[model samples]
Target: MKIPGSSLVRFPGNDPKLMLQMPSGGRQNTENSQLITAATVCLVVFGILAIVDGVYYHDIKYKLYQDKESILEHIYHTVRAVMFPIMMYCLFAHDFGGVLMIVGIGAVSIDFIMLIFDVKEEGRSRNRYGGLSNDEYMNHVFANTFHFVAIALILAAKPAAAWTIDPSFALGRPYPQVTAWLGSAFVAGGVIAALLHFWQWSQYFSRKVAQS
Candidate 1:
């Protein structure tokens, strides 16, 4: 049984000194836990893979750009390319919390949905580019599925990191307020990016009607 205030410490065998020397920082003590460290490393590795996937998978591997790119596909790629590096920055440098985390999660979820539109656009374009190869379909599917799983894992592993920033910081802020300002920028960027997609879609549809 664990003692009231003392922590349990076992190292190969029972040792009183090891137990006595243990720190009492609760969750803080677990900041550098093996699981968290592994998650952080995996986050970085996934971020790198996302970068590579953003660059090559859409165009070179899938030939998304071979014909006239669909508005949906272009916007999805644009947001994805912009966000991948910012996501790495959040994982490594900023470690934002609370509202920022919410915004990040919402943005990523929307991006995932946008990917569905992209895939549909691809299907419509098969007449132009021919049917997707087995490798192409698998690669696209894996990239789409892996990102959702990675996002879920990162959130699960670092729940504390998710809400580090307080809502109060958002109020009474000016240009130089770090969290508030930066969070606003992220929100604005997300909104603008989403709007751009719709705007492009409108243009694309209008052109299609004109051509018809």
Candidate 2:
């Protein structure tokens, strides 16, 4: 049984001569911790592989220069992982698929907003070091709002398309194909982003390590 307060390392209170020889801080740090650094390194390596696939996947280089909201470019976004497939299905105005696409987009927006707030609280994600500054806050707000609106438009497009194109035939459903196709894209996007971020972190720390 652990005694209350027994975890502390105690030197004898009465040992006058022994006290003279002791360091001001007590014994060296005595606890062991499970460090995630090793895991992060492994993740970073895997992320590099994913990044290569992402950069070249689906002729992404060409698509990047395409229209900002174009499906081809959206397919390459692979960032949120869902944006593309839902979009593709939406492109066809697959009724249910389009709605789900908006839902997914909403989720991404919410998460991003939460992240912005959380990061801002911690003073992160702006400038070279990635923290929010006053000037950048509006930009962040605008970016998120735009994406959120994009999702809404995407959601709205399908039903409208289905309704307008054919009164007797229904073309849209719950976006199964879009969901399936885009699932990996979303996963790959997350892995890629994490890798890039960690790569930057490692570089920063490596430089500091070298300097020291």
| Candidate number with greatest lDDT | 1
Query: Where's the lowest-lDDT run of ten residues in candidate 2?
Result: 28-37
In terms of lDDT, model 1 sits at: 0.49
Best by TM-score: 1
Tens digits of lDDT, candidate 1, 88-142: 3343234344555566666676666667776787666555556655656765666
Quote the positional error of residue 148 for candidate 1 in Å. 2.4
Q: For model 2, what is the C-alpha lDDT against the true structure?
A: 0.36
Pairs clashing in candidate 2? 81-186, 94-172, 95-172, 97-175, 124-130, 124-131, 125-130, 125-131, 126-130, 126-131
Candidate 2 lDDT tens digits, 119-192 = 34324212323444444445445444544444444344343323221122323123334333443454455555
lDDT (Cα atoms) of all candidates against the true structure: 0.49, 0.36
